[model samples]
Target: MSNSNAERETWSTRIGFILAAVGSAVGLGNIWRFPFQVGQEGGAAFIVMYLAFVVLIGFPAMMVEFVVGRSTGLNAVGGIREFAGGAWKYLGGLFVFIGFVILSYYSVVGGWVLRYVFGSATGGYIGTAGPDEAPVAQQYFFDIASGLDALLFHALFMALVVLIVALGIKRGIELGVKIMVPAIIAIFAILAVYASTLSGAGEAYAYYLSPDLGYLIDNWKSIVPAAAGQGFFTLSLGMGVMITYASYLSEDENLGIDGGTIVAFNTGISILTGLIVFPILFSAGVSPGDPGAGAIFVSVAEALGDLQFGRAIGVLFFATVAIAALSSAVSLIEVVVSYAIDEFNVPRVRATAIIGTLIFALGIPVTIDPVMVDLYDIFAAKILLVLGGILLVTAVSWIYSDKALAELSKGIGSFSGIGTVWLWTVRVPVLVVLIISLYLGIDSFIDFLAGPFAEFLA
Candidate 1:
């Protein structure tokens, strides 16, 4: 709080900001959720819908976050209050809360990735390495996914996220993403090429890329919501990440171009992930199976084990996952840490430590029981994320339309026409799509909540 707005840290370069934003967008949501969701839904049809939603819903929503952040040059709560004062701060607080709720369990999954890295390196999980590896990998995942090992790795992962964030925006976040994002792209690109040479690549590509329009038409009701959720999830929308990252921008930076680039890179990386995962699984005669950690840790891990040099590939693959998870976790934690430092006068180091500890503690239930992870993931992804996206678009489009346009106009230049078009996109298509996603998500919300409530009442 001692530092003026002028003294607050900003990205050292435009590319640095973009990489950090892309890093936030590309995480387990892309690598973990995208492939399984594609498989569990109708494969190519789901993917087609996801891409459409990303263009229609995700991109505009991201622009809204960027507009809010860059205009105010403040954290989510302060940024909203700058435009619409009074109780509107609660909306911003909801964003900060989403960051906490997400990173809590998110880091648990990050922990699992870290353990997989170790397990792959030492042949710990490769004993039954083959096409039949999934059942063994499932048992292996079940064993370490909870209890003391899970707790230890979860703490370890949280520590890494806190360390990077505590280093501050330029040295911590920007620097970390600069290194992590390229490595993610490079590794996945290489993996995609390798996966392409597999015999099943033909079938996998057909399944992943060749849209079944008839299937999509038949399943439009289900596929649309899932696609919208994935679009929001993969792009890091509805989570205050874009808002926090954009806050560090200079006035003249082009939000539209940067937002577009981030979305492009995120969607490309997610598609690359599907390329790597599906081909490998099909080559091994293993289905991607149902969504969740099983799709990656069980199915993909098993497929990797069946290949030549599978262990080495597993290490490299899971290490990339670890990097992606850490990069995204940094943004999530920064959302809260930046809030504390900006609004509460807390030092960066102290805020990170205290907040990181609290998040890790919140993840303890996730370590104690896998059910906690499912409940948290479903609620956050299905309901909270979509709801957040809808509210943000509503705020910028209706509540602060003039202010939002003025901020966007700062560096818009030749893209000035986009400002008006984007406004309507936010008002209609983005809002309507997200509302539908939220409504469809209610069934899942109820299903996930019912299990825990049933257990509690029993």
Candidate 2:
């Protein structure tokens, strides 16, 4: 089919489109990062702020991206240029590049989950460390985080992503999401139920739910940025992944309702993650305050080691996580591939291969060096995401204001009345908040860079 004809074909069903978008949004960010961020950011307050941002900022931005994609029926660069004009085409390119960088590091992390699932199945790391003490588990995680082992797993992960994208939107991407998203939710529900039976589950619930306002006060400088970043990441913003996915959308669907549904599902999974993870940690007598990625792997692995059917539980948990991670990675790769297809007129398969090859090459530093991996993760999550958000806000608000409103108002008859509300109230205020949040996020990241030397010595 011609590209335009293909674009004309909307999702076979609304559920399919919602499932696909939710699959892209609900991933490692929801399961892996959200719990840890909540623990670090004083739990309840951070959760509240995150919800607020999702409603005020993330929801509107999602609508904007959906409008841009469906209205133009083009990938990111083409969508922005067509909707707003030539001046903002660079904004779309920025989104594509940001998506590229994010997927590079994200694939590495997804590879780690793939390895963990294998290890869980093989009973590796079981019985190696006590729940309250995870030194051996931490070392095991570090060993896998570096060298040729890491590279192999990254390649394996990237290959899975490429294969899915090569299958085209309807056959591969949408179908995979339809299956994976439901599976993720089902698995998480089962685990959350299981976690509630742990000895100190009550304490875990308290830790996650109770608001320690003082912690938020003391850590506001750090917590706000963390919350904002997590909010954006959880919703898959600033990456053009949403734009690419939405490009497949037909105008008959309601962007606002779909966008709200996606955000709700994504945020719900994040909360579910906290429910599952914190209970397990607290029950195992592990401190939730331990910073760094190792905190999750070591703590959760140790907890699983002690359970009655720990091996099986570990396998299921990590398998779910790995699937979630891979699903998001595929979405990210699609963004890059879509840009290639749209801008360079490359075939979808060729574009997928080309982008996959570049990611495979760029992933080496992350696989070989622990420090580089951390730096890459930090840069993509903190710096590039905020920059992408700023550019998107500029493009949507100033350049494409009328077009955005018109597109966003396509369906839902009188509900379009709120277009003015979205633009003047939600969009403008959130843009301002994003600006302030971006500055603070950058500053906090710089401080983290500067303090590492002291932390190392200590």
Candidate 3:
């Protein structure tokens, strides 16, 4: 490659960089996972706790990742090693491994979204809409989520991710995010406006927006960890994805302001998603606590099917999700490719190809088995994120220390005062809460597994 091409590969305009990072941070975790988690954790209460965690914990943790990335201009492995010295490089390796593991399952769900988009266009699930939409959607979802059909779509999604990253930073990553982010927001906004007109919209809003203080008291043991994990997942934390994105940023950007903007945008989109989805589902008489991730698909599509513009709405909604999922998947692929290029000195195109191929291969199990899809989803969402957050906290608090803090304070003048508060008070307490929350979450999860719910899995 020419030097000009190589130089072009490293550069991204400020807006492009911000959009790209926000695009990665905002995806299925926000749209799909957030509403469901809120439904389970008592809606408004979960939202309140989640917002607190996002502002206090997620934001500071994001800044630390940003600091590491901008300070070293290296991928996760190189950044950790450079900032924390020799013994801490393994922490970087841990991040790379987690990122790879997450991509394997994440691509599976992205493929499902791809399948649904095409299915909606072809009128596959249109006739199957019902009051108890969960069961109907589950059957259709199960039929498509496994075996050769899923594998082909997963390969297709992975291929798209590879093609984008192969184009390098500016033309590929930044440009795609620039287009996709606005498209996602515009489409979701249109849906939210339409949902507002539904007959059961008022009841749906109450169900989703009203504070259920009693549920919070009953489930606080489970709710804390669920909220924290959801917060981390929505921000794409613990997988080194943000760290990779931050590596591309120039020092002139204020880490505090940029990180805050990303978090706010991500959180805002999630809130909009809830407004769009829950109102529609509840207005249509669908319960919010419906089991399985496919519940949303079933409920929303069924409601849309009954409307005058049902097919059109269904097509647009699924299409929005497909675009959002693809944007995030591309970011995940970029993280892996960035590491390959930075650590091994591999060409960007070659690294993208290699990592994409590996993810495609690893996604096979999830694609071929319905059970494995749910298993992988649960493992990644519930287990991997909590463990990854723990590692991130340990690395930031104990290993990097003042060096990380110093890098975080650079360029952003106001950040020095607020950043110090973040370091000593906010960061430490949040980490402690995450640890305790993880323990409670695991205990509750195990108890749930061993209880009557075990039969459902069997």
Candidate 4:
């Protein structure tokens, strides 16, 4: 039961590790959150700020997690403790908490996605009648998005996550991501090509790619925070996912190159998703600015239902989401699972089982109520995620600066010069933005607590 580096499982290959890390990074945030944010925040302008934040903030912050994980070769909690010791372990504890809470509601959404996949194949919602006068797809989404069917699907999805993580690093996670990430990219690429041929493709492309500088300049304050949050979440920076995933890596792997590649792939996939989504919405004469769950479940579903061969395409789209969700869920559950296995000397299967069941039980409220999903996200995912990132960056940049640089220097040849730049980036801009984002997130979260969240607590 000793969780030594010698006994611990490492990723089988560099590419396998990259794919798994990319899988962890690319999730509903890319497919579900990104396009909606783009639409809601003025399309190309938001994308512009998003990409800027990715380079300026996300990449360096990611490297901080990479160095922390690979240096300790331990789970999130153990990793921070190994390097910084004492109270710093709370930083890693925050990671475990975020992973646990986020996955609860995340799986609920995953379940809805699975239902959509099945519904698409069965034409369950394609031509169905609405109870009232609402659109069939919209009504169908409302029905399945919460309640009994949602609970069942959520359990089903969480079971898949637990099964994969319980199988250990190589056999389960590496193997799963190798297949899933490539398949996700392939499907999105094909869909983007098909989407380009849609009727309103021209307008969609214009809206998605052509930024109004005036809009960005005029709305930089709001757009900047939204884009920063999106960039941070999409890269999976604040969640300790990168830390957990990087722990499975070998020393010879170039961390800098791998980080860049993962970011590149994740960013590209996110943009490609927007390309596929906007055109479909535009073609169907559906506005893309509906935001959040409505953008994907109702708007996209309605659009797909109206297209030729729409049912088949819907199957592919939701299936991709299901896969993406599962892939990300694997990493999230693993953060907690790995923590248990590494710190408590618990067996992987037992840890996955106990932890997965607890997470599923936690998700029940969100499944039944649905409103808890947003509440859980703002309070658990966004706030804690930013806090974790801030703590990790501070610990790396100040408390363990030299050691962090040494670890980052390993396997990075010409990139060795990056240590100082990375340090300052982590110290200055990354920390500044994360702190600002955390403040804004807390402000909003407190507002929620005072409003609807208070009602939920009651």
Candidate 1 Cα errors over 4 Å, as ranges: 1-3, 129-134, 451-458
Q: Candidates 2 and 4: which is better by lDDT?
A: 4
lDDT of 4: 0.87
lDDT of 3 by residue, 115-173 (tens): 88877777666665467655555566777887777888888888888898898888888
Clashes of each: 0, 0, 1, 0
Question: In model 2, which residue pairs have backbone atoms overlapping below 3 Å?
Answer: none
**What lDDT would candidate 2 get against the real structure?**
0.80
Q: What lDDT tens digits, residue by residue, belong to model 1 across residues 1-458?
A: 43357868999999999999999999988987788789878889998899999988789899899988988888888887776677776888989888899999999999999999988888666556377545666777887899999999999999999999999998999899999999999999998999899999999998888999999999887787778878887888888888888989999998888999999999999999999999989998888756554456778777777888889889999999999999899999999998898898899999999999999998998897666777787778778889988888888899889998988988878778779999998999889888888998887668656766457446
Clashes of 3: 1
Q: Write the per-residue lDDT of candidate 4 for residues 288-369, one digit (tens) a residue.
A: 8874444567888889888999999999999998899899889899989888888889999999999999999999998766
Worst 10 residues of 4 by lDDT: 288-297
Cα RMSDs, all models: 2.2, 2.6, 3.1, 1.9
Q: How close is candidate 4 to the true structure, as a TM-score?
A: 0.95
TM-score list, all predictions: 0.96, 0.94, 0.92, 0.95
Clash total of candidate 2: 0
Candidate 3 local distance difference test against the native: 0.77
